[model samples]
Target: MSFINFNFEPSLQEGLDAMGFDRPTPIQEMAIPVIMQGKDLIACAQTGTGKTAAFVLPILNKISKSGSNKLNTLILAPTRELAIQIDQQIQGFSYFLGVSSVPIYGGGDGIVWEQQKKALETGAEIVVATPGRLIALLAGGKMDLSTLEHLVLDEADRMMDMGFSDDILKIVNYLPQKRQTVLFSATMPPKIRQFSMKFLHNPEEISLSIGKTAEGVTQSMYSVYDGQKEELVRHILSQKAYESVIIFASTKDKVKALYKVLRKEFDIEAFHSDLEQLEREKIMSNFKNKAVKILIGTDIISRGIDVVGIELIINYDTPSDPEDYVHRVGRTARADKEGEAITFVNPKDQHKFVRIESLIGMEITRNPMPEGFERGPEYLGEKAKSSGFSSGGDGKSKNKKKKKPGNKPAGEKRNSESGFKPRADFKNAPPAHKQEAPKQEAKKTEPSDTPKSETPSKYGQRKNVIDS
Candidate 1:
C-alpha cells in the first residue's frame, strides 16, 4: 500500500515524499493507522522491515496536529547507535512539519549534555534516549516528562537483553499513566511479552516475518580453523565484488584486530563502545558517505543501523543467539535490494550456527574452503565444549570462565588492547594504549535483598483503550 492512502497531514505527506517513501511495508501498513489512532501497540517485525517509519510517521502527524510545544513523545532504545539513528530519521521525517527531537545518550562531552538539557527545557516535542542516560538525567533534576503523551520502546527485546528492565520500569515512574505506549521488536520471546503486559493496556498486536530473514539476502557459511580464519577473510575481500561491507566480530578486541589487518588493503574502520562518542559518530558518517568502504564492529551495530546499498556482511564470528544472527545479516539486503551474508564458523561455533539455521528454517550453504588452505577442525557439534565467553549450554548467559590470551609465534606479538599482531618489520605501527576497564557486560537481575525502587508505578491497573 502506498503511504498516500493514509492521508496523513499534508506537511507529513510532503516529508514522506521527500524521503522517497511511496509504498508502505507490511509492518508500516498495519502499524501506522493503529498508532495514528493513539492506541497502544506491540509489533513484532524483523530489522530492516521499515518499522521505524511505522511509528515515527504517525507520531509526527499527531504532534503536528496538536501543535503543542511541550515534550510529547519519549523513545527508549537499547544502544546509543540506535538512539542516534532514530533521532536522525525523526529529523528527516519531520522536515516539513515543525516537530523537534533531541537524542540523549552517554559517551558524549559536557557540552552535548548541556545542549540536551537545553532541548529538554525548551520543549523539544520529542526525546529519544538510552535508558541509562535518561535515568542519569532524571537523577540530576534537569528534565521533566510529566507532559509526555507517547512512549515508544524500540527493540524492546534487545533492551531487556541489555539488562534495562529495571531501568525501564524506573523511567515509567516519570511518565503519565494515561499515555499511549508502542513497542516494536524483532523477536517476541516470553520475557518481551511479559514486559509488554506490564506497560501496555490491551495493545493491538502485529507480527510479520518473525525470526525470518529478508528474501533478498543470500546466506552462506564457511568452516575454517581458528588459525586460517584471517586467510579466509583476505581471500573473500580480494574478490572486490562488493562495494560496501560490514564485518561483525564477536568482541571489541576482535574488531580492532580485523580493522588493523584490513585497513591497509581496504578503506576500513572499526567501531566499539570504547571509542569516544564523537569518534564513533564520525566513523559512521564516513561509512555512510562512502569515505570508508568496510566497517567492522561488534553486535552493538547488529540492529537498527541503516546504511543503504551495503552489498556484503561478513560475520567474523558466529553469534550465540539465533536471533542475533538474524539481526547481523539483516544489515544488508535492505530496501528490497539483493545482498550477501557470510558467516565464519569454527569447530566450537558449529553448534551455534546449527541453531541459527534451525531458527531461520533453512540450512545456509557451506562454501568449500579455498585451495591451498589447511583443513579446519571437524565440526563436532555435541562433543565440542565451547570455551571463553561462549554462551551457556543453552546459549543464554555469558560464559563465566576467564579467558586466556591466545599464544602467538615468536617475534609476532599481539597487542593486548587491540589484539592485533603487527609484522616485526613494520616500523610505523602506532603504540598500543592501555585498554579501558571493561564495562559490566550485562547487569545481573535486581538483587532480591535490594531495597525496592523509590519510584512507584503510577498505573496499578490497565485501562484498555483499543477502540473496538
Candidate 2:
C-alpha cells in the first residue's frame, strides 16, 4: 500500500518523498514487484493510474541496485508528447538517484537532434523515445543499446494504433534477447496481446478497470444537433466555474473552429497535429500553468498530456471508438482527484456514445438540452442496434429490395399493406387483347358524378356556369 514497503534505495525514497508519492497506485502496486523481479510483464491499466511510475520506479531501483550507470533501459512511447512526459516522470522519480535520460523525438531543431545523438552515444541510463525517431537514429548507426537490460513499451496499444509496430520490431532487433521486456497499456485489445506475445517471454499479466473510466470522474452526455454543438459547449462553459478544462474534438478542423469561437470569450488555446511541435508545447505549457483555462484539441492530447486537477473534460465530438471515450475522460479525475466529463452527442454519434456506455458498464446521465436550441435526436441506442442500417434519417425503413406487386405472399391483401386500394373499375376491366379497339381522334371523357354545367380544364380547374 505504501511506497516505503518496496524498500527502494535511500535516494529513490528521498525522490518519492519529494514528489509526495507515498502511496503506490493499484497498477504500481501490482506491476512494480513483477518488474523488479526481472520478469517480463503485460499490465492493463487506464490512464491516470500512475502507470508511468509503475515501471519507472522499479527500473530505476534495479539499475541503482546493479551499480550500473550505462544505458540499461529503453522506453518507447507513441507520441513526442508522451515520450517527453515519460522522460519528465523519470526525472522526478530519479531526482536524487542521479538517473539520466534524454527524450528522442522528431520536430526538434538541429541542436536538439545533436543533443539527443550525444546523449545516445555517451549513454544515458534510460532513453525514452518515439519509435520513428529512434528507428531513424538506430539506422544511422550512431546510438547503442547493446548494454540495455530493460525494455519498456509504455502505452503499447497506442503505439500499435499509430502504426509503430514495425518500427518497434525493428528496434527490438537491436536489443539483446536476455533483457526484460515490460509492456504497459491502457486497454488490452487482441492486437496488443498478440504483439506482446512476440516480445514478452511468458510475461506476467495484470489488469485493472479494463475498458472503464476512472471512478472519480462524473460522466454525463448531452444530446444536441450538430448545428447547436457550439452553442451547447458555450452554454456548458458559461454555466459552470471550472478552473481547468479540456475540450476534445474529433478532428483538427473542429479543434480550430472551437478554438476560434472560444478564444475571444475565454483564455483558450488549440492543440492539434497541424501546429508545429513548439507551438503545441507552448500551448500545453500555458494550459498546465493555468494561463490557459480551456485547452481544445484532437485526440493527440487525450492520452499523452497529463495535467493534474483538470476540473472538466468536454467531448466536443463523441469518439466512435469506446476506448477513446475512456481516455478522453481519463484526462480528468487523475491522481484520485474528482472531476467531471461532459460529452456532446449528435444524432450520428449517438450510437457511438451508446457503445461507449456499454463498454464502460454504465449508463451516462443524459443532460437536458438548454433552452432556445432545437430538440436533440431521440436516443436510438436500441432501435438502431437491433435493426442494423435499417432506418434512414426520417426514421423510415430503408428496405431497398421491396417485393414486387405480383410477388405478394399468399393471403396478403395489397390495400392492407400499402394503405391504398386500386379503383374498383379496374377489377372488372376487359382483358388487354379484347380491349384493343380501333384508334380515333382524342375526346374528353365526362365525369360520371359531375354536373354538366361545370367543365374541368386541363389543369383540373373547374369553370362555373353563368346561370349558377
Please state every model's RMSD to the true fold in angstroms: 10.6, 25.6
Error of 1 at 369 (Å): 0.5
- Candidate 1 C-alpha error for residue 17, in Å: 1.2
TM-score of predicted structure 2: 0.82
Instruction: Give the TM-score of each candidate.
Output: 0.82, 0.82
lDDT of 1 by residue, 331-395 (tens): 99888888999998876688888788878989889887664445554555444544442432222
Q: Global lDDT for candidate 1? A: 0.78
Q: How many clashes would you count in candidate 2?
A: 0
lDDT of 2 by residue, 1-468 (tens): 899999998888988898788889999999999998999999999899999999999998987788787888999999888987887777677767666777788766565666667667665788888898888899999787789999999999888889999999999999999999999999999999998898889999999989989999998887766666765676577665566999999898878778766654566778877665666777788889987778888888988888999999999888978999898999999999999999987666767877898899998998876544456666777565654533333322222123445645633433435332333322223235524766454234211111122433221111111102
The superposed Cα distance between candidate 2 and the true structure at residue 132, in angstroms, equals 0.2
Global fold similarity of model 1 (TM-score): 0.82
